[model samples]
Target: MEEQRVRPGGPPAWWGHGPPWRDGADGEERRARWPWRSTVLLTAFVLAGSQIAARGQLDERAALDPFARVLLLIAAGQLLWRHRCPRAVAFGTAATVAVYLGAGYPYGPVLLTVAVACFNAIVAGHRRAAWAALGMLWAAHVLVAHRLYRWLPPSGDTAASWGQEAVTAAWVVAIVALAELARARREQWARERAERAQGARRRADEERLRIARELHDVLAHSLSVINVQAGVGLALLDTDPEQARTALTTIKGASKEALGEVRQVLDSLRTPGDAPRAPAPGLDRLPELVEAAADAGLAVRVEGTAPRLPPATDLAAFRIVQEALTNAVRHSGSRHARVRLTREAGALRLRIDDDGPAAGADAGGGGNGLAGMRERAAALGGTIEAGARPDGGFSVIAVLPLAPPHREEEDR
Candidate 1:
């Protein structure tokens, strides 16, 4: 009966966990704040303007009333909570203006304060409230103008009255336009920020997938070697003590190498703030890997000619050789394997052929090891082929391009 490897449970390392952007979306929004200092300064400025307007208009009308000053104070103070309660602030300020006009206090700078409140309402996304305030102020202006025209001799539809009404329209339109423009800019900035965050998260996911492939390759090969050597050791411990010792030693070496590579792969996930670590295992490590396979009692022959390869291609090549040797050692009943490598036409080609039972190969075919190898090669803009070699054994071949998959897009 052919050996059957026990598979690990759970989804692939690359899967699971909701989209990173979804977590970002669930984050709390920044709460609105009312700038106490700025509000105080604005209120002071409004008070000063009202005082000046009242001073000038008082001589032309009735003396200033004490209660009107208190109402003015209340309107100015409401600015402190403008962000927290924009509609309330706007309504409060507008009502203050109405009171001033009704109490016969000259409509001077208090009108400007109410307009500012309306602008704040619009800025807070309270468009309905702002529009209501605008209508109220306009109505107040019309009524006040009519009353003054009827009672005051010099104010009978005078140019001053018409001029004030015109200026009111201009100011109202200006406030609404400026507030709407500010809102648009705020929304645009938010969208840009969200897009940037999503892009960052996307890169993180791709990085995670890459690391998962590396881990799969490392563990799969190393465990396969260890498993085979352990079996050999256990079988021969009594019959051939020396050979058993050698098998145990081989298992140790293979496990140690696997652990080191695994550590290196994990270090890649370390934060940038960590001390720098070594570069990943590359093709230069292939000879050592082949030696490890030989130690595992497999006859591994190598014939390779290659120039300096890119980092990604080099890593893929090492992992491919490692995975092929691991499969050969674990499942191939035969003890002989061949590894051939060549750099041709701007690509690296690797081929591993083993005299292993096609049955063991068939049993391991659906494993993540093979899937990971294919994924790694494709990620580096390459391709892989693994199948039974017609006569009796299994073969794995990989062709890796020098350039990355996104090279053209990056260049552009």
Candidate 2:
């Protein structure tokens, strides 16, 4: 089977793990069903209220007609879609309540569902629709009051008292306010989650870049040595057996060193249940790096004592040196290179110069070696410059702060 390659800059697989409710459309669909379920529960309450009013167990003026009962049930049914189409359902339920009140029916628990519809509108971010529905209810009550006072016989009673209408308005406003408050809280929570996801993606990208730098440093130097020695061995096999044998031995040693470093890189990625990993390469390992570069036919002279460094700075500095040497060996025709290190004012300075023919010696041209070194330096709050010198050769210089960034506290 072909290996699955994760695209560069893609979010890591681990970041994709979380509660299913936060996965977007599917979770919204699941949550949308709750309003309907709530409507089902509210139906029982509406039915009981109607029964009590019909039997005169409660207010006799609030007894609902059979047609008004049908209308109430219809309004309750409209509540089922409140979450999916909050504005539409709010308007439908409020209109049904209005018609029920205007048709000379006694007011009962039917309009109670209208409060829920308004709440759903606010929860669904439709505050305007919720307000509009509340306004329509108030107007309906006004018309009902006017019809009773201006036209009804003085001997007869109104379908609903002004006190009842005022109470319903208060309930509608309260429910909408509570729903809007909840909506605000939900929005805040979503914003926080999005920010966290962005942070995780950034950290993942930085980690992948660090690992890429490590792999490039290890493989580039080791492979360059192996390639050069293999060519030498092939060239001298016919006449100079001892030189060819020495070249073959260098290739074997370089390959072994490359395998060990690459294995360490992979081990760093092992799951928690795996065996403990060996420590990463640091400044102390520069000898091995220098030897590998020398095996590739570059004569290298080291200067200055390596510093006792923080883990991040140590790893970054080592990679920078390794990448610089790899470039010197791989890209240059010269035989000698110079590496100088200095500790000054709480920072480490590295300068690498090679006495090579400066043809096509652009540092970052067509390769990530120089760019990786620059990234390592910048990540440590430092700077790197790689370019051709004024006289003739190429040079790589970097300054790395010993006081690592706050992220270094958390470790790899």
Candidate 3:
């Protein structure tokens, strides 16, 4: 019934959405409104400037017309709501700029509002819409310019009929294209950030699965043997006092061993800041593990001397044997088992055979025990194959690399 607890500061399984405030109402309340506040202030400044320009145009000495002044005011007001509806604001501002220019309002600072609106529309992911708005503004500029100036070209232009409208359209198109490029760059950055977050979550999930598999292998075999011995001790308590006492002693020893194994498994979850403890069982503990299995009423035979292995390889070997013996005692109902460990050229081979009940003759008796053993071996750069023998027995075979293929040997 043990559960895995997520450690604080560990990488999250998934990236969170939006800003911190969007994640929770409480966070929203605590967040500062500085960005929005600054936006409002800047907007007020722009509006004030626009009003000043309008007043200057309206002065008696100024050559500006009244109609052009009115168009400038309308464009400035619509820009105040730009963030709410960027596309609409861009269209309104562009139209006003066209009208003001046609009415001879000097067409100077008034065009700045139209430029700002175009930038806002493209940045808000409305590139096509911004282009369409630009076209409409160009058409308006042509119509008004032609009507107000009596189809005569402006002072600098040659007296070509269609050249003025073409020049105006080109300018609007160039401005909109620049804004679209800026928007595209921003979108690329956002996409990169999203991809990095997704990769982090995927790696975290993989780590979680690996940890779960290791824990299952470590706990399953040890607990099964302990449970069987305890059951035997309880059963013998009434009929045979001496046998019962012996069984009880075995139970105590098995319980202590199980506790040590459990502690070893849990210790892996500790951080570097935590206190250190004794090292976990490795290849050195193989003989002791075999003895423990014998005490649990399974006769185990050990073969060939094993080479010195890395801690990870050694631990994987110990667990594989432990799981094999546990299976024999639990499912096979057999009293005898044989375990062989051999150091070959570049690999360590482990073979365990048990003459348990024929019915359950399979790797760790074909349940969680075998699956856990296979998982352990695989984690240590090893492979395991378990099945029933033709002679009414179960066998498990594992091949583990002594050292990683690409890495040089280090102090073990």
Candidate 4:
């Protein structure tokens, strides 16, 4: 049996890990492998420093005690695995340093090791762990200095040494804080990139929906009319040859028009580097559109003074009337439809009514044509009212503002 391959964009297995690559596989690989190399280098440096410290002691007993040196080397080497287990490394290093300090070992590179451990703890996303490490290290430093090295004054005059201790503490804290900030910045950048990718996917989905809606509106009404005419032509072929020829000619014209409309939509989807074509059906094409519907056996009436409209508004108006006429042909089964376009004050108004069946029952309440018209109107900051008129017919009235709404302008 062949193994089932996981196709791109397919659903994952039931028990699979979350998203497999939310941060991407490449980033996961980097996070998994790079830390070990840094850990190894850190261990080598720590071990070499311990050896040098064991050789150069102010006290003879401290220099002779090799076990102290060995323990210090172990503590330093343990830091090599800090990225893997930051909290464990931090506690272990702090304990080792306390023991070395209590045994009269000099505080040469111990502070540096503590700083590295604190930084690791922060990067591991353990804030409490870092605070605990800092507290433990400071307590151990004060206790060891007071009991063994007398780094603090014997007279308990802290002002003399407090400044030095405070400066050193501040340096360590600053380094850890900087490391934490860097980690936070990296996480923020990753989140921003993920959000942008999500937005792109969402936009692609919306574009696909828009195309599907356009295809449905364009094909549904055009194909319905063509189908009806073809049937009529076939029935009249022998008895009325002239009528049959006219029906056949109408069918051919409708098919050609549908093809051109589809091609135009597809061309709009193409990249800008491609050759330019005729613009989409705007107000300029209104006369041609009216003629086409008239040829389809619908006496389409146009009224009102046309105004200079924006490109988007003009496109919306064209599509609205196109869909309205298409619906009229499909649902009303009527021979006459009226379209009215008027511009008043700061708004444009469009009204399409047909003497078909009442709007509620057959004027496509939930169909694609009605939905497309509503979407087109809404895109132009407009409101559309489509329902049955009291005079036993369907009416569609849309009112669009000359300029987009304030909210829409803010979004732009």
Q: Provide the TM-score for each candidate, comma-separated.
A: 0.78, 0.83, 0.71, 0.79
lDDT by residue (1-412, candidate 1, tens digit) is 1111111113652122221111122211212434677667867776777777777875454445677677777878887766566788888888878767655666666676677778767755678888788778777766766555455422323324677778877877888888777555544444555555677787788788888878888887778778878898999999999999999888888788778878887776776437537777787877788777877778888897656887877878888888888777777787888989887788888999987675453523557778888988888888999988777788999999876667443211
| Evaluation by TM-score, superior candidate among 1 and 3 | 1
Number of clashing residue pairs in every model? 0, 0, 1, 0
Q: How well is each residue in 225-272 modelled by candidate 3, as lDDT tens digits?
A: 667667877888888878878877877776787677667556756653
Clashing residue pairs, backbone N/CA/C < 3 A, model 2: none
Candidate 4 lDDT, 1-412, residue by residue in tens: 1111111133542112222212244434533654556566766776667557656754432442576667667677767666556788888887787777656655566656667777767655666777787778777766655554544322322222667568757876796787677556545545555565677787687677777766876787578668778887999999999999988998898889889878866875886346537666676777766776776667888887568887677778877887788777767756788889888778899999998764336664456677778877787779898987777678899887777665422111
Question: Relative to the true structure, how large is the alpha-carbon lDDT of every model?
Answer: 0.71, 0.74, 0.66, 0.68
Clashing pairs in 4: none
Query: What lDDT does model 1 reach?
Result: 0.71
lDDT-best of 2 and 3? 2
Instruction: Please provide, for model 2 over 270-388, each residue's C-alpha lDDT reduced to its tens digit, 9 standing for 90 to 100.
Output: 75336536776788987877777777888889999778899889988888888778777777767889889999999999999987675354532336887788888888899998887
Model 1 ranges with Cα > 4 A deviation: 1-39, 58-63, 98-109, 146-161, 269-276, 343-345, 360-366, 387-395, 405-412
Pick out the ten consecutive residues of candidate 2 with the lowest summed lDDT: 1-10
Over all chains combined, what TM-score does candidate 3 have? 0.71
Q: State how far residue 61 of model 3 sits from its true place (Å).
A: 13
Off by over 4 Å in 3: 1-83, 138-148, 151-182, 238-243, 260-280, 359-363, 379-381, 403-412
- The full ranking of all candidates by lDDT, starting with the best, is 2, 1, 4, 3
The ten-residue window of minimal lDDT in model 4 covers: 1-10
Q: After superposition, how far is residue 39 of candidate 3 from its true place, in Å?
A: 5.2
Better of 1 and 2 by lDDT: 2
